[model samples]
Structures are given as C-alpha cells and as structure tokens.
Target: MIAETRIALKNAGKYKPEDISTYIDLGGYKNAEKALKSKPEDIINWIDEAKLRGRGGAGFSTGQKKRFTNEAICDKCLQKYVICNADEGEPGTFKDRIIMEMDPHLLIEGMLIAAYAIGATKAYIYIRGEYTQSISKLHIALKQAKEKGFLGKNIFNTGFFLDIEIKLGAGSYLCGEELTLLESLEGKRGYPRIKPPFPAEKGLFGMPTLINNVETFAHIPYIIEHGVEHYRSIGTENTPGTKIFTISGDVKKAGYYETSLGVTLRELIYDLAGGIKQDKKFKAAILGGAAGTFVDHTVLDTPMGYDLLKERGAVLGSGAIMVLADDRSIFEMTYSILDFFKHESCGKCVPCRVGTTQLLLLMNQAKHTKSDRIELLNKLLAEAEYMDQTSLCPLGQSPILPLKSIKQYFESQF
Candidate 1:
C-alpha cells in the first residue's frame, strides 16, 4: 500500500490544468455551487466539526478564522476580503506551487467557497514572483472561471459576487506573513504590523480578512462536497483530512506527497519518499521549513500530526520535510538557515533585527576559542528567545525554532 491520501493533490499531474473542461469533468466546481446555496454559518460549523486547521505554519483553526471574519465588528468598514497565500517562499516547501501549477482550478474553487462563507466580495492571490508557471496557470484558470460564471457577479444566479485578483510578490519571504502580505498587496513595503488588531478585525485596506494557504483553500471544496464526518475519518481526531508534504534535501524522491496527518515519519521517508538518498542513513530531518525544528533519526517513528509533533517541540509547518544525510554538516545547515533569516528580516522590530545580525556574526567568527564559541552560542540562544517574545510578527520570531532545535538535537556538531 502507498499509505498515502490524495485529497488536495487529487487533480495534480492527472489532467491538463489549463483546460476548464478537464477540471469540470472531475467535479471541480460542484462544491462551489453548494456553498453558494448554503448559509455561511453552516459551512463554518461543518469545518469546525471536521477539525480542519490551516496548512500554513500556524496550524490555526480554518473554520474559526472564517467565523471570526464573519462575526468581526466591522462597523468602520463594510467590506471584507479573502486572501490566498500562494507565496511559497519557505525553504524546502513547494506544495503550494504544485497546486497552483497543476491544479489551479481547485484553488479557485476553494477560494470561491471560502469567500462565500465569509461574505467577502473581493479576494487576492499573493503569489511568489518566481512562480512563473504557476502564475500563468492561475491566470488562465481565473479567466476560465470568470467566463463560466463560477466567479464574478451573480455566480450561479445566487446574487453572490466575488472578484479575485492576482498580485505577484517580489520574492520577499516576509511577505508570507499575513500582515506583511496585506501590506504588500496594498502597494506598501513588506513589513509586518503589530498585533492587538489582528487580521480578523482590521486587515487588507483596514477591512476584515480571512487568509489561508493554497492548500488550506484547496481542501474546502472537498470538505463541503464530502461530509465533515467523512473528512474527519481520514486523519487523527485533532488533525483531520490529508496533508501535502514537500520532501527535499537528501531524500530519494524529492517531491510532493499527500498523506494523512498521523503517518509515521519512517513511513514517509522509506515507504513514500523511497528512503534517504544513496542508501545513506538518515542523520536528521527538518520538519516544517527553515522556521521548523530539526529531528534526529531516533524520532523516525514519531507520528506526523500537529498535536503529536507539538509535544516534541516540532511542527508540521507547511508540510516540509527536509531530509539530512549523515554527510551533511549540521553547522553548515544551521548557518544557511540563519543567513536566509538575516537577509529576510523586515527590520520593523528591534529584537529580530539585532538578533539575526548578532547570531550571524557569532556564527561567522572563525578564530574563537572553544569556550568562546560555547559562550557565544548561549548568548545567541538567549537573543533568539528574546526575539520570540518581542518581535512584531512571525518573521522576527521564526529564528528561535531552528536555533533552539538544532542546539538541542545537534549541539555536538557545533
């Protein structure tokens, strides 16, 4: 058995993405029509019952987010927005790009359902600039959807209107942050806004907004078509439905694989991804992306789910599993991750701005004594913890995850 589920990626690599006829034949827009006729609260309730969480790094409740936007006190602004976060810039993560490239219509259908549920008339897809093929495919798909009346005014004669626009990002990793994405979509520099006025209250031109990743949106139509009970039956009780994992680095099959949330890491590597490359022993795996924690080989049997991994100080962040072979240097890998964060820090907060620079400088110093290196490492970890508490947005706080996890699991390499 493959021991994998194909919910979000069901249409991927199985049909021509540019053709609407191909998508329609596979029951593409059927759930979208269902959503138009159903009450928004009914859809939200079903999602809540199914326990569908965000496929984004946060793992927040998707139904709760929609409910918040629906019930938000938006007296100041009458309009609401729905955003598709297609900016798959996280290192070792490319699942969203595949969906946009190979199954663009699925994303469109999911977005329509979400918009209808949240009562949002306007939506935006903030895609990465590097995704030329995905963008092109989404463009064609959007045009087809509009022409077929799956989008635009009076969709399916239900008097519901939703217009989705595409905004290409300039490859700023910080733009993947929901607030920063809103700023970028509004033609401002990509900098994260402070919390207290969360996106559910004020977002996207000072209006309520519901933001979710491409994969999170893609599951909506499936959950709506298939009952919530059916969706819940696939995965564990807490994290129901399937997840799309992007395995890279030393894996033999370095690509996307969709499976239930609670599958063992051993099965994912050996059974699904053809095991480590060159028959080498697995030294470690970075669950999630650069902002994710590192796991040693001993934890290969650990279940891959949100709550299960959280107990081990790990995350299924965006479903990225970067396999590291024994030959790979832990120091070099840590340095590379730190470098990405150093370059991508938005500089809006002092803790993140200074912490990333200080960490990089300490790691770059080659002439330090052994004791000095250890002392510097301790200070860098302190700084990372401080950043986690004080940083304005997730970009500033992300450095702590890798730094702390690497220090815990691979400190001897330092």
Candidate 2:
C-alpha cells in the first residue's frame, strides 16, 4: 500500500482540466503572478538551489538550462523562445499524456513562469499528433487561460507579455529529441543538429531557445510555489522532487504513479503496482522505455533516481517501468525492441541507420544460427557500442542501452 507522493499531479483529477476557473480557485495562477513580481534571475537561482533536473530522460539541470538561456547573448532584437516537448513517443511511457489531459492548466502555468524567467514572449508545445485527447484538452485549457488573462500580453498589469501556441508532431520518434524537434519546429526535416550550439545557444529559428519536456515544465510551478527548501526535501538530495512513473506490462495495477525520486523498484512493483500479474514470478523489468535498460530481480532494492540507477548501470529514463513476468521471453522482447529502434531511426545518420538495421538483422539471424549464444551477444554488444560512439543523435546511440543490459543480465536467454 505504498502511497503516491504527488506534486506535478497534485491538481490532476481534482477538477475540470479544461476549466481555468477551477484551476484558479485552487490557487493555480498565483505562482505565475508571484513570479511576475520577482526578478527572473532570482527565479532561476531558486531553481538552481532546488536542484531540479529535467524529467525528460537526460536528467540535466533545469536551473542551469534556464540560466544559460537567460544569460545567452543574441542580437538583442532577436526574441527568445520557450518550447515544451510533449511528443510522448517513448513506448510504455504515457506520463506526459496524462499530465496534458488531466492538468493542462498546470502545464500552461509552468510554461508562463518559464517564459517570464527566460524573457521569452512566445512559446510552443510540440505534442505528438496521436494524442488527440491531450491536444483537445490543451487547446481548451489554453483558450480558457487566454480568456482569463493568464496568457497573451500584459498579466496582472505587470507589463510582461507572453503567448503560447501548439504544434503537432508527425509521428516521428526521433523528433522527440530536442535538436531534431527544433529542426522540425522550424519547418525543416526532423534531424538531430550538431552540438556546441545547443538549444540554449541557437534554436527555434536561430535564436536563443529554452526547450524542456512537459513533465519538466510542469514541475516549475510547484518548485516556485513551494520554496526551494521544501522542494529539495521531497526526493533524494541530488535529484529533488517526485517523478511520474508510467508502469505497465504484467502488473496488476499497471498505471501512472507519482513518487519521490528515491523510491525503489521493489516498492514500485510490489507495493505500488501490486506486484506481477496473477501472482506470477517476476522475471525482469525494463527501467525505462524502449531505449532503456533491462534488469533482473537482483536490482529491485536499488533506488530509482538518475544517479542511483546510473550507478547500477541502469537508467530511470522517462520514468517508464515495464515489468515482465517469468512467462515472457527475453529473446523475443529484445528482438522486438531492436526492431523498434530500426524502424524509428530517422536514417539521417550512418551509424544509427546502418547500426539499427544491422542489429535487427543480427537478431533475426540469431533465431536460426547454431552459433554460441555468448558469441552472438558479444557481437551484438560490439555493434551497439560502435553505434554509440559514432551515431549522431540519441536514436542512433540508444540501441546499445537495451542490448548491453540484456547481454549483462539475460545472457541465458540467448
């Protein structure tokens, strides 16, 4: 009976998601008003002190990103932009969709605070087109906010102006990556851009842009509304705040649960999610989504934080935990995962394109080959490592995560 520690989801399901009045009645836009009066740099400092990290798999510091975007020098006439990544394309990860559908106003308020902090007057939410309910809910919520003066031009008579728009993604998994999403946002093909000029430097039509995922932005209001000390008190010292985990597959109570950062897999699977389905033996769990690690029961007690999981050579990517019962086949799951990477590769880079295809081919060949399973695993690991080094974007580099983890934990399945 482990209870959820809700923060971003605090207002979810408590009122009409599309109604601005219900959100306001619950003291929703008060933080935005409070933030409007405070110095933007102070807000950024609070975030930095709070140690809020991006919830979008990368786990980068949110405050550092804001400070970079705020201090970044452009032509002065060039306007800064704030972009929210809502492309929820990760397999088995639906937390963003839940936030968008259940508490769209919270997201809107968070974006408003972010726009003010970074001096951005215009913002966009690039959501996956497949999220029809979320899109509709966000549209309604945006309209309501605008009507209530929470968005668009001067708010609380403070003279700060901001407007937000929604952009639909065309079902490209690579577009979920920030750089690729930037290219797509600029009406270009979805492809990862080279680094050094990160989004905080040149982004969204070649201006200083601040990009954060839906969950990352949704946490802003809470961090601001509650003091930094309060926020830092919830999760582990390094990784503050709760995370919305989307658990599915072989779990009796498979759904999204928001818990503090240090919650263990054992607590998540057994206490929160009610353990494996039908009292079946737990075989393994995918700690992240498709491009995540596979772990056996041995690491159940390990805490589910970014640094903690990374210490175990696992990633708490997108907070997507997919449980597997003993009846599931690891080889079949690995093949399917490889196949997904192969199909999703944007083919813009050689390593990822060729690497994904070759990896899938190797898996297909493994089905018929009488060769030593260890040798096959070694071969897959070698190829994936090469891709990790040379591939341009995360898509090109992601196959190695699952492949390497599977090789480490489930070699017998080969």
Candidate 3:
C-alpha cells in the first residue's frame, strides 16, 4: 500500500457536512483569524516562506499570487473577492468533488482564509452543476457559517466581513479557465478573454479577485497553524505539501488519495490504487488530465508533481492520474477525449473549434484504411503544435497535446 499523507483532504471523508465545530476543533480558521490580526506583508512572507504553489493546472507560486492580489486590492480600492474553483472538469479528476461533498466546512474555511488574507469582502464557491450532493452539503454548511457570524459582517470580532456565495456553473469545461469562469458567473457565454490584465488586476466585474483551487485554499489554515516549516517538512523542499490525486480507470482500488509532493506514479498505482485489476498488464498512464501527456509503464516510476513531470514533457495537470490497462483501446480513449474537447471548445478559436471536428472525421475514416490512420496521426500532431503556439487560451491549446503525446509515447491501436 502507498504511504500517503493528507492535508487539503484532512477533514474530507472524516467529517459531517454541518459540523462547523469539528472544523474549528480540527484547526480551521486559525490561519484566517491570525492573518486578520497579522500584517498583510507578513502574511505574504509566510506564504512565500512556505513555498506553497497553486494546485491549479499552471502551478504558479501561491505566495506571489497572493502578493499580487493584495497589491491589486489595495490599489484599486476595490473590495476583493475570493473564489473557489470547484469546477473540476478534467476527466479522472474527482478530488474537488470529494473535498466539497465530504467536508463542506473545510471548503468554507478555505474561503474564509482567502477573505482574511486578501481583505476580500465577499467570496464565491463556483461549483460544477453535476455536484448535486456537494451543493446540498455546502448550502447547509454555508447557512451555518452565516448564522454563526463566521461569514457575515465583522467576522470573529475583526473588521473583516465576508459573505460567501455558492455559484453553480453549468459545467462548461471552458469555464475552468479563470477569465472564462468570470464571464460565466456574470451570465455570459463561458469563453476566455485575452490576458495581460489577469484576474488579479481586473476580475469579477473589474474587482481584484483571488481565485484558487479548493485544495490550494484548503492548505491556508494548515500553513498558519503549523507554520511554513511544518508545511514544508512533508513534501519536496521547493514544492512543499501534499497533493490530492483522483486515480481512475481499471485500477483495483481506484479512488482519491493524498500523497506528499514527491510521490511516484508507481507508488500511487501499484500500492495505493491496488495496481491493475487482477494484475492485468499496464498499457500507459495519463498524468494530469486528458490535457496532460502519457507515460509508459517504465516511466511510471517517475515522480508526480509540477517540475518532475515537465521533465517528461507532461505536467501534473490538476492531479488527475488515469491508468489505462493493457485491455483498453487507445483509439477509443483518444477519440473520447477529443470529442469532449470538441463539445467544450467554446468556439472562441478556430484551431480548436474546427480542428477537433476535422480530427474526429479522420479518426472515423481510419477504421477502413491504414493510410487514413497515419494521416490522422500526422494531422493530430500538426494541429496540437499549432494550437499550443497560437490558441487564444489553454482551452484550445491543451485539447490536442494529450493525444499527440499519447501517439508519440505509447503504442496506439490503428
């Protein structure tokens, strides 16, 4: 079995939905309250000292993001907004859903920490529409938070008043991008805007907004209570803290598992996920999500995180690790992933919008001729190369990378 560590999911699968006291008792809000009392620069210092990186796809430094948010909020004279991106659209990624549904108060506490740290007056939890149970749980916990004065005006007798709203996303995958998410929240079409004026500068109706993944915010209380050193002790020195991964596909014990930053994919699968079911042969593993690259069984021993995976031409994209056993067909899986991209492509860029359909058409015709399959493979590579270089945002940019990586690294069925 894998010797995994837990942090963001600390209370997950171990707490009642409405148990605010359990959260408080388990060291929640201590960080936010401390941050509320401490100097803002000190808070930024603590974050940078801990070396906490974003758990989102980009894996940016959380400290730097917070510093930027603090600066933006101060300059704009805009009441900051804290948003929890619980719209886990990547297939094989279920950590966010597990977090929100299992320990709703943890999500709430995470939001509160952000509000305190950034001087945010309001917060929003953007959830996927498919998370019915998670939404119900959060709603109850939210009411409890408001009634207990943890969320309403002047929290904990401090001048920080934070009202957290739970917003339901219609599950448009394009909205997973921060800017696109803001547009969707405003009841507009969920399409990404060009960057330069990032969300930290202009977000949520031109306010300085700090958006974080559920797990990233969840680490704040722990960091405050334990100090930066304590948080750094568990994971790699630079990439400190544990990451929650959602392992799926034909594994023996597929589920969510939390491990330190340097944990290997082999340790996660063969040990934590109970290896291939019935000890079936391994074909390949998709690190991150469908947007991530593929790795063969030999490379499964590689570590799972931001830096190491990049060395392998992949990324730890949202901690969604999917295992493909020998019995599964790569053609079918690749096609399904491409189709999902097509449906969620937002039509904002021509490369992703038209390119996906063209790839699909070629794949459909590949059933008859070998040359057709090879031609489709070449086109897939070309499209991915172009998309990565020219697309407006990551939505179109990443749709084809996984397929191209799979084709290059793994033996796909023609």
Candidate 4:
C-alpha cells in the first residue's frame, strides 16, 4: 500500500490539458513570476540549496549545471540557450511524454525559470517526433503561454524576456543523449561530441547552454514554489523529491506512478502495480529502461535511488521498471534488446557501429550453437567490454549493462 507522492505530476488528470487558465488557476506560474523578480544568482543558489538532481536519468546536480552555465565565459554579448530533452526514447520510459501532454505548462514555467537563472532568452523543447499527442499538446500550450505573457518580452514586467520553440526529433534514440541531442538540434547527424568541453561550456551553437530533460525542468517550479526545506522533507537525504516510475511488462496494473525516491521495488511491483499478471511467479525486473540492468528477486526491497541502485551496480536510469514473469524467456528478451541497440547505433564510432552488430550476431550464433553457449556469452561480454571502453557515446557503451546483468542473473538460460 505504498502511496504515490506526486510533485511534477501534481496537475495531471486534474485539468484540461490544452487550457492555460486552468493551469494558472492551479497557481502554476506564480513561482515563475516570483523567480523573475529575484536575482538570477539567488535563484541559482536556491536551486542549489534545494539539492534537486536531474530527473532525466543522470541525477546530476541541477544547481551545479545552472551555476556552470551562468558562470561560463563566452563573448560578453553571446546569448545562452536552454534546451529541454524530451526525446523519451528509452524503451518502456514514457514519463516525459506524460508530463508534456498532461502538464505542458509546468514544463514551460520550469524552462522559464531555468532560462532566467542562466541568462538565456531563448529555449527549445526537442521532443520525439512520434509523440503526436505530446507535440500537439505542447504546441497549444506554448501558444497559450505566449498569449498570457508567461513567455516573450518583459514577463511580469521584470525586464526579462524568454521564448520557447518546439523542435521535432526524427526518431533517433541516440539523440536522447544530451551531446547527441545537441548535434541533432543543430541539424547535424546525431553523433555524440567528445567530452572535456561538456555542454555547459560549449553547447548548442557554441554558446553556454543549459540542457535538462522534461522531467528535470518540470520539477523546478515545484522546488521554487515550495521552499527547499519542504522539498527536502520528501525522499531520501541524498536523493530528495519524488521520482516518476513507469512500470510495464507483466505487471497487472502497469503504468506510470510517481513516488518518493526511496520506495522499494517490492512496493512498486507487488503493491502498487498489483504484482505479476495472473498471479504468476516473478522472475526478474529491468530496473531502468532497455539500457538498464536486470535484477533478480533478491533485490526487491532495495530502495530505488540513484546512489542506492548504483552501489548495487545498477542505475535508476529513466526510472523505468519493466517486470518479467517466471514463464518469460530471458534469452529472447536479451536478443530483442541487442537487436534494438544494433538498429539504433548511429555508426559514429567503430566500437558501437560494429560492436552492436557483432553482439547481435554472436547472440544469434549462441542461440543455435548449444555447446558453445558459454563460450559465446564470454565473447559477448568481452566485446561489450571493449565497446564500453572505446565507444564514442552511451549507445555503444550501454549493451554491457543489460548483457552483464542478464548473464549474472540468468546465465543458465544462455
């Protein structure tokens, strides 16, 4: 009987998705108005004090990112940019789309606060193209926001100006990565840029850019509206605030549920999601999305937080919990996941481009060649390890997570 602690999703299912006034009546933009009057440095300090981690998988410090972008040195006249990563490409992860379609204005207000905090007048919502409903709802929400002075010049007469535009992603999973997403935003092929010059220093159009995902941005207003103490009162000491967990697969009531960060997987699966479908025995759960690790029933009561999961060699990536029944085939699921990585590889670097294909081929060979299954599994692990060490981006490095975790928990199947 673990209850949901809804913060970002507070307005969901409670108002008209396309109506701006309803969102306003719910006291949506009041925080943004209050934020506009405050000094940008003070706002950044407030976010720092709140200890809001990025909700879009990375769990980085939101305040640190803003501070970096704000303090970054460029041509004094160069404009900074705020971009929202709404690609939502991770398999079984639909929480961002829900935020966009259900409460688009919340995202807008969050972006507004971010842009103001970082001294940016322009913002973009780079959303997945296939999300037709999300795109349409955001379009209407942007228009409504512009009409209401929530956007554009001199918002709340504070001499601050901000405008947000929507950019459609052409269905590339690689673009969900922040650096790769930046390349796509610039109309280049979706390939990841090298590090050391991270996005905070040199991002979109070679300016200081503040890039945060939809869920991360959506949490800003809440943190601002409720003081840092109130915000910290929820969730764990290190990972404060609620997380939106999207549960799918064999669960009886599979969908998105928002709760505090420390909720156990057992609570999420057996209690909230109604357990495995048809009373079947539980086998394993993919705690994150496709790129996430697989876990057996032993870790069910482990709290779902970034640090807690990381300590167990797992990630709370994308907060996507995909359950599996004992009757399901782990090998088949592993193969399908490998095949997906193979298709999504951008071919930017040799490791991912060839490694993904080789992994898939090796899996196919192992499936048919029963005697060498262990040998092939070893080879797969080695190849994934190589790719993890050498790949240019996360897509190439990600196969190791699922491959290793699956092998660890279900080697007998292979």
lDDT of each: 0.89, 0.91, 0.81, 0.91
Quote each prediction's TM-score.
0.97, 0.98, 0.95, 0.98
Q: Candidate 1: which pairs clash?
A: none
List candidate 3 stretches off by more than 4 Å. 73-76, 372-375, 411-414
What digit string (tens of lDDT, one per residue) describes model 3 on residues 1-414? Answer: 568788888777565777777777766666667777777678778888999898877899988887788788345464778888888888888888888888888778767876777778888888889889989889999998788787888887877788889899996888888989998887898988888688787888888888898888878778877888799898887688999988998799999999998898889988999999889998888887878877777678777778887877777888998898888877787878777777778887887787767667767777566665656777777877787788888877886668767766764453
Q: What does candidate 1's lDDT look like per residue over 1-414, in tens digits? A: 456699899888777898898899988799999988999899999988888899988899999999999999966778999999998889999999988989999999999999999899999999999999999999999999999999999999999999999999997999999989999999999988877688888989999999999999989999998999899999898899999988888988888899988898888988989998899989999989999999897678888899999888788898999999999987778888888999999788888898889888878884353456556657778888988998888877888898787777877766
lDDT (Cα) of model 2: 0.91
Q: In model 4, state the lDDT of residue 320.
A: 95
Model 4 scores a C-alpha lDDT of 0.91
True lDDT of residue 395, candidate 3: 72
Clashes per model (N, Cα, C within 3 A): 0, 0, 0, 0
Tens digits of lDDT, candidate 2, 248-351: 99999999999999999999999989999999999999988999999999899998899998888899999999999999998889888999999999888899
In candidate 4, what are the lDDT values of residues 1-414, reduced to their tens digit? Answer: 899999989999888879999998899799999999889998899889888899888899999999999999877647899999999989989999999889999999999999999999999999999999999999999999999999999999999999999999998999999999999999998989998698889999888899998998888998888889999999998999999999999999999999999999999998899999999999989977889999888889889889998877788999999899999988888889999999999997999999999999988877776666667778889999999999988899899998788678778765
Question: Which TM-score value belongs to model 3?
Answer: 0.95
